[model samples]
Each structure stands twice: as structure tokens, then as C-alpha cells.
Target: MGKSRHEKRAAIREHKEARRDRCESDAYLDANSRVIKAERNIPWWRR
Candidate 1:
């Protein structure tokens, strides 16, 4: 049998949610890497 309307909507919602979650994690990792790079660049006098 074909999927009901509710099932189709639910699948679409799940796909969107997964995409959003991946984007958020990627942003977090990018920010963290930048911070680490900045920390490594600090001069000994400033630490």
C-alpha cells in the first residue's frame, strides 16, 4: 500500500531535522578549530 499523508510528512520532517543537526555540528567544529588555531598562535609573553 502507498504511504499515508501523515507518514510522508513525517519522513520529510525527519530528513530536514537530520540536515539541520549536521549543519549545526559542522559549524561548531569549524568554530572550535578557529579557536584552537588562535590559541596556538599566542606569544609566550601573552600566555
Candidate 2:
């Protein structure tokens, strides 16, 4: 049997929420890596 309209809507909402969460995590990781790289570049005397 085919899914009802409400069921289809719920599935789409769930998929969107999942995608948003993944994007947020990826952005966080990218920002964190940049910070770490910058810290590594700094010399001990300056830090």
C-alpha cells in the first residue's frame, strides 16, 4: 500500500532535520581544524 499524505510529510521533515544536523557538525569541525592549525603555526615565544 502507498503511504498517506501525513506519513510522507513526516518522512520529509525527518530527512531535512537530519541533513541540517549533519551540516552543523561539518561546519563545527571545519572551524575547529582552522583554530588548531593556527595554534600550531604560532611560535612558542609568541604563545
Candidate 3:
């Protein structure tokens, strides 16, 4: 009924990879992204 050792290690690796992706996504959408989107709305003449 128990998982084998390889299955346990694979599960741990998947968990760590998911956690890393979450952290990266949070960092990716900070003030920089906000500024970029805001900039798109302005005409070239305005800037």
C-alpha cells in the first residue's frame, strides 16, 4: 500500500518546482508590469 522510494522523491521534486513557480510569478507582476501596461495606453507624442 505504501509508495516506493522513487515515487516519494519525485513527489518532493514536483512540490519544490511548484513552489518556485509561484514565487517567480508573484515577482513577475510587480510595479514593472503595471508601468508597462500603463505606458501602452499613452500615445507616442505624449511621451
Best-performing candidate as measured by TM-score: 2
CA deviation > 4 Å runs, candidate 1 = 26-47
Off by over 4 Å in 2: 26-47
Could you tell me every candidate's TM-score relative to the true structure?
0.53, 0.55, 0.52
Give per-residue CA lDDT, model 2, range 1-47, as digits (tens). Answer: 99999999999999999988887787788998999999999999998
Which has the higher lDDT value, candidate number 1 or candidate number 2? 2
- The per-model lDDT (C-alpha) reads 0.92, 0.93, 0.89
* Alpha carbon lDDT at 1, candidate 1: 100
How much does each candidate deviate from the true structure in C-alpha RMSD? 6.2, 6.5, 5.9
1 versus 2: better TM-score goes to = 2
Q: Which stretches of candidate 3 lie over 4 Å from their true place?
A: 26-47
* lDDT (Cα) of model 2: 0.93
For candidate 3, write residues 1-47 as lDDT tens digits: 89999999999999999988887686676866898999999999997
Writing each residue's lDDT as its tens digit, candidate 1 over 1-47 gives 99999999999999999988887797788998999999899998997
